[model samples]
Target: MCLISFYLIFVFSMTLFIFGIYFILYDYSLFIEWEVVSMNSLSIVMTLLFDWMSFIFMSFVLMISSLVIYYSKEYMFHDYKINRFIMLVLMFVGSMMLLIISPNLISILLGWDGLGLISYCLVIYFQNVKSYNAGMLTVLSNRIGDVALLLSIAWMLNYGSWNYIFYLEFMKNYSEMMIVGVLILMASLTKSAQIPFSSWLPAAMAAPTPVSALVHSSTLVTAGVYLMIRFNLLLYNSWLSSLLLILSSLTMFMSGLGANYEFDLKKIIALSTLSQLGLMMSILSIGYSKLAFFHLLTHALFKALLFMCAGAIIHNMNNNQDIRLMGSLSLLMPLTSTCFNVANLALCGMPFLAGFYSKDLILESVLFSYVNFFTFLLFFLSTGLTVCYSFRLVFYSMTGEFNFSPLNLLNNESWIMLSSMLSLLYLSIIFGSILNWLIFSSPILILLPIYLKLFTLFVCFLGGLMGYMISNVSIYFYNKSLHYYNLSSFFGLMWFMPYISTYGVINNYLMMGQLSFKLFDQGWSEYFGGQNLYFLMKYNSQLNQVLQNNNLKIYLLSFVFIVVILFMFL
Candidate 1:
């Protein structure tokens, strides 16, 4: 029964995906709305604004969700809670669809909040300690974005409407409304796991692989980028945009560096996801929103495929996530190896692949923009780092000696998983060209020197060389040759991001909390408001009791004393 339902959903989603693609190709833009409330001067509305952008994104989301669902049938066959898993994924898909179509802030909240809550549910679906911890971190990190959205909505009340679309033009004239952009930027950062909020993204690997494929790759993480894309018109020449450019470039460089030191297969992919997200954000920050959206879609195709391949590898290798234990699988599992290599190559922006179209455009756009040396250096270096880690992944998993003992690789090749992977592989190869044709009338033109024109190619070659050489040599004597142990450790541990985000942030707040408790809860408030007040009340009550017991005589004596005092004054 569950299997039947899963297939039904997949079929239904696929149908919608095809229809959406057709609609987008026809250049059909729609504004569908219904009035929910008509107040004295304000009308609450429920609206779905569907255009080419939404259609493209929604179609991709549905398609990826369908494939991920199909893949889950075999990957999660043993689990008793498979039905619950499917339902959560469907809910996630629904929430993302809502977000994709929404044009109003109030309506977007319904989807934005839904994503945060549903992702928390999905993350802890395993109910293990790791899942629970990761879920908590993921939820808490997203809560910041949630709060920022709510605050932005509240601030938008100044316009007497929650329809942010109406305010974009108004915002241009009123510079004071830049606060909304800043808040929205904050929200986007948390959702996309930029910088300080980045720990949860890799930690979120504790979730099932299918969840990672969807949430990290196509849907949840991109929500921020999608939001920024929607709001890009408002951010023209804004300082917040410049800040995002700097921060996102740093994020890109940081994640690339982290992926080099990472051995866990899934976490390496997750960090790569982070790095790509940084690319999307940095490009969006520079005001090339269309380019960002293009990359987002192409990235969705390949990254999801990458995660699926990684999941298959993990499942076949007795759930071992360490790449150190994997090697020479190309000979053993040709299909999976081929798919993995293709996805990795695409992610590295190999020419003619899905990623190259958007990634190359992005780098060229960066070159064309008026950016400083720091930003330009980070962008190019991060580009090289991307290829570097990708090659390292390929070498570690596909080229080196078989580190693990022999297993029946033939038995591990599940038809269901392969079908799902191949479906996406098909898209990963051709989706970018399709999008380029549909969206751009002609290719963007840029003129640069020969070296600059071939910058990405040069970087790719240099990175591949470094990756192949380092991965081969480091595997045998990594520990023996580590002279700069501290420097190596810093990059390995993601610049201590996990430690800093967890213990570093927690310790400071916890110490402050303890001090606050001692000073206010225990010391000042307890002494003055609780204990001191209680003692003072007790003394007053005792005095009152004494006065009441001797009230008659004491009243008479007091009256006589007053009369005598009055006589003496007179």
Candidate 2:
């Protein structure tokens, strides 16, 4: 079943890829619209947009999803619910495809909600407490974006059409459209896991690794960036763009710093995904939607590869994920390690690799754009931090002495998994160059000083060195972080983002819920509503029973008292 799914999806991916290329070459776009209803000058239509961007993105999504499905056959072979997992993954891919093709806000909402729902199911696939918590965080965080999209839909209703593509050009002329743009920005920020919504991206690592690779790399997280790209005109030159730039830069910086202190292999990669997402968002915020899209495509290729390699390692290590306990894996699992290293270097934007093309272009563009020093510093520092964590990951998990028990045997003999990874491996190597050439009709002119041009390369080298040194220091010393306990905890704990997202954001609301339960549901409502009415009725019934039991004697006394009262009145 998995193989059949893989073959079908792979074929579809290739077909879409070819179609995407043709569309781009010819600058052609196909829009299919079906009018569902027309009433009182209001027409409801379902729309699908097939253009170079949507086709290419859809193709990449399907390709990665196919490889992941193939990889999961081995990764989840021992599990009883493997079929369920495969179905959920396929559903996720479907949601992403729907999102990619839809230009209308309503149709986009359908796909957006589908991604959230399916992602929740996949995250909790393991049915453990951790998985459950992670799933909750992931869903609730994404729900914010869902609400934003819904609001945008409602706001766009005033414009007489749910099709946003028609309005993007004219929206900038009217100030009311700025609200729609802001709503879209909020939705994108949450979906992409930007600042204040980032904790879920890493916590979602509780999901199966294949899900991680697909969700983090392309489907769920990238949905935001994709949305922003579609609405680039709405956001371009708006205050929302500047806001997005600041938040995304902080997101990038925070995640990069957090990844360095993280030991969980999947979480580290997840943070890296967060960092890269911030990069995409930042670039998009600065009017380089195409550049952001370029980075997004290239990022998907290598990040998916990175996650698969991590999955393979975790599978061999008997489900252990702590990088601290892994070392010298290259000796035993040569092929997997090689693929892992390639993916890592590609992530660092190593020369001639997939990441280098997009990342290099993005940095140059940032330098070319007139921006504040703060944004510039965050960009370069985050770039270095990315290299730092990548190298740290390689050094700790792939090199040095073996840290596992001597009796444990590890090997990269899982042909099914390795083959799936190998499929993506070459793409991670060359996809950037291919995408760069295809996306741009002509070369982008980036004019920068010699020093500025070399800056990115210098940061990569320095970050790699720092990563190596940090790993060595930690290995040699016992509890080195204990000295800077508070500082370490802050960086390691994602700047308390999980706490803020879960405990911080929910604490007041939870307290209010509890209070409401006590004051209304349990206390006031119970007393004044059901219990109080019941007691009052009981008392009246008791008095009636006593009056009824008084009989003839009480009747005689009542008559005498009435006569006396009449005489006094007279």
Candidate 3:
């Protein structure tokens, strides 16, 4: 029954994708709204705005999710709760669709909250302690975005409407509205896993591979980029834009560095996803949201394929994810290896591939733009680091000695999974050219010298050299490399992001909670409200008992004494 349901959903999604393509071809826009609530001076409506942007984005999302769902049928077949997994995945897809179409903040919140809550459910689907921890982090990080959105909605109240689309034009005129823009940018940073929130993304690899392929690669993490694209008009301020650019560039560099030292197969890929997200967000911040959107869509294609390939390799290797334990796999699993290599090359911005179209363009734009020295340095350095880590990944996993025990790693057991990958593989080949043509009617003119125009390529070559030569030398001369243990350990552990974002942020609050329990609940409140009150009542009762025993004589004596004292004072 689950299989049939998934198949039906895939068919429906493909149908929607085809229609979305047709809409794009005709350059058509669609708006369908229904009144959800109405009152004096306040109203709520469900509005879906489907233009080229939403259509293209939704079509790509549906395509990738349908492939992921199909691939998961076999990937998760042994689990007892396969149906539940399918349901959660379906819910996630629906939430992404809701987010994509929503133009109003009210409806967007509904979708955004759904993504956060459903992602938590899916993250913990394995029902282990690690999944529980990872789920908590994922939900909490995304909750920051939710809170920011709520604040933005409250601030938007000053504008007299919940429909942000209507007020985006004049947002700069109002100081409060500009603050709302900053809040929204902060919201995007959290969702996109930029910098401090970066821990949740690599941690979210605790989810099953299919979920990672869909959520981390394309849908959930990219939601922030999509949101910022929607709000691009509000980011005209230089200070806010510069702040965004700095944070996002640092995120990119940070993740790229982390990936170089990472050994876990899923985590390396997750960090790369983080780096790409930083790329998208950084570009979005610099006022070329369309180019950011272009990269967002293309990155989704290759990254999903990358995750799927990693899943295939892990499935064959009995769930072993350490890259050091993997080698010479191209000779064993040719199809998956090919896909992985293709995805890696695309990620490195090899000419004419999906990433080349967008990534190269991004670098070119950065070169032409009048950015500060720090931003410029971070961009190029991170771009080179991207190639460095990708090459490191290929060398460790595909080019070295086969370290696994003898086992028949067949690639033909699950034709469904293979077919899904193949479908995406075809897209990874051609989608970049297709999007490039559809998105930009005219080419962006570059005014750089030839060498400057080729700067990214030169950087890519140098990075590839550094990755191959340095990693190879380290393997051959382990003792020599050990001299840099401090640097290696720091980068390997993601600059201790997992610890800081988890323990560093929570430890203070948890300690304060314990202190409050001890100081107030147990000590002061318990003594005054419970123990002290009991003692006072008991003392009064004893006094009353003594007075009762003495009867009317003692009461009369006490009253006469009190009257005599009052008279003497007068």
Candidate 4:
């Protein structure tokens, strides 16, 4: 069978890269054996190259693919549509493999788009109205990202050397690096769900539990972070690096807030991931490439575990989704309880877990970076927000009082689900302590930060405690002040009109008493109404009407316009 062949090839790849993920997670390196792919493969025109970064990323993909299989095998075991799920997942795995292994940026893009297309199909496969909406939204948002990527390629092709190495060299010489920088940054921003481009990911929570668990949380969303790291040189040199930093911080805070307000089991994790990627971006912004990559690698492991555990939770609740109706899962399902607690603790970034190491590393790198105080503050605040929402989801779902129970799973729990979650929990616990040997070439530099690492652990737990307390209180009240002011009120609405009118004076527009424009009477048939009033009447309406129709038509036809007018604004 084709499935068997792909699985065997995948196993072989994992066996070859044994040291990649195992070292980070369990220090289980028994599987990986390394060999260099021939450097002289059929070459594209650009200078082809291989580097340590590419090697590490490929290895991470291999590990994730292996685990995804482990998950798919048990998760989709008996469903009538099992074959379809298996094929889709395998396709996802192959895309990830090609992405990480590719030496050329063009080649990298093949896997990037491949992963996105496959995810869209998987999300929509259930054919439910919710699933269909999620898939369409996913497609819409990712296309905004594709436009950015195509522009990035255009910039490179127009100005830089066509080869990867020469491209980097070419970038070093360009005065308009800002143009190239913005395009690349935009692509990654949309892909990573960082602000203004972020609405699609939350909507994507409509997919099945397993797909949500594996693809959305751990694998697919991580592609953007991988891209950022893969092209760090662009970030390191460009003026937009600081912009990336600030955007990342804002995204972290915003998504964290969303996750707190979410009720759906899958959505809680989905929002959590968007915030996690924000943290990763901020990490990259601070010049900590390896640190950010480690967090990505670390997050994929624990998040996958958490998503699977959430899947099991949904199954046990008799399809009851609201945390309000289900409670006391800790006692009801001990194994699920244990796995949930472990993964949640890891997600909470508890000490000594896989989450703790990468997180502390990111914070330490941020604290120590030469960036200014305000940047540090935003970074710190985002960190606090991530912890706040992560455990809010955990406590609400698995820890409270039971109000209802599902009939079929009143006491049912599957071994496959338990083992899959347990594997992730184990990896998150020990990943940081052992697997970072290659990343930390200097023992002494890593040693000075022991106290700071412990502090982050404490802060992580404290954030979780605060989240638990805030959960019972209404969110509106938690954020509400002693008194709230309405922005649309008379004073607030009129407050800015005078300033704008004053500025309009510089443009030679008379606001003295009348809204009229007198152009310096160039020899127009001015006395007879400018150049040709009768002729103008044939082609034009009032400015507002002309604009309203012209702009309105263009705007109305846009996806963003339709969504904004009908959905967001309404």
Model 1's TM-score against the true structure: 0.89
Q: Is candidate 1 or candidate 3 better by TM-score?
A: 3
Tens digits of per-residue lDDT, candidate 1, 1-570, equal: 445755676676666656667776676778899989999977777988878788768878877888888899988999988888888898998999999999889888889999999999988988899999889889988999989999999999899877787788788567899888988889999999998788899988988999999998778999999999998977786688889998899999999998988899999999999999999999898889989999999999999999999999998888888998888889878899989999999999999999999999999889889989999999989989899999999989988778876753533468999999998899999988988877775777888888888987998889889888778788866654378889888987888888888667767888999999999888877887889988999999998888788578888987999999999999
Error of 1 at 64 (Å): 0.5
Tell me, by lDDT, which candidate is best: 2
Candidate 3: residue 93 lDDT (0-100): 84
Worst 10 residues of 1 by lDDT: 404-413
lDDT of 2 by residue, 264-375 (tens): 9999999999999999999988899999999999999889999999998898888899998999999989999999999999999999999999999999999899899999
List the candidate numbers ranked by TM-score, top first: 2, 3, 1, 4
RMSD of each: 4.3, 4.2, 4.4, 15.3
Q: Which residue pairs of candidate 1 clash?
A: none
Pick by TM-score: 3 or 4, better one: 3
Measured with C-alpha atoms, the lDDT of residue 498 in candidate 2 is: 82
Off by over 4 Å in 4: 1-10, 19-52, 159-161, 406-408, 444-455, 472-570
Judged by TM-score, which candidate is best?
2
lDDT of 3 by residue, 1-570 (tens): 456765676677667667667776787988898887899966667888978788778778877887888898888889987888888888898898898888888788888898999999988988899999999999988888899999999988887777788788889667656888888888898889997788999889999999999997668999998999999988776478878888899899999988887789999999999999999989888889989999998899899999999999998888899888888888878888898899999999999999899999999998888788889888988888889989988998888788876674645437888988988888998999888987887776778999998899999999998889867976666545468888888887778887887898877778999999898888978899888989999999998888879588888989999999999999
lDDT of 1: 0.87
Q: What is the TM-score (0 to 1) of candidate 3?
A: 0.90
TM-score pick, better of 1 and 4: 1
With a 3 Å backbone cut-off (N, CA, C), the pairs that clash in candidate 2 are none
- Locate the minimum summed-lDDT window of 10 residues in model 2: 473-482
lDDT of 4 at 125: 79
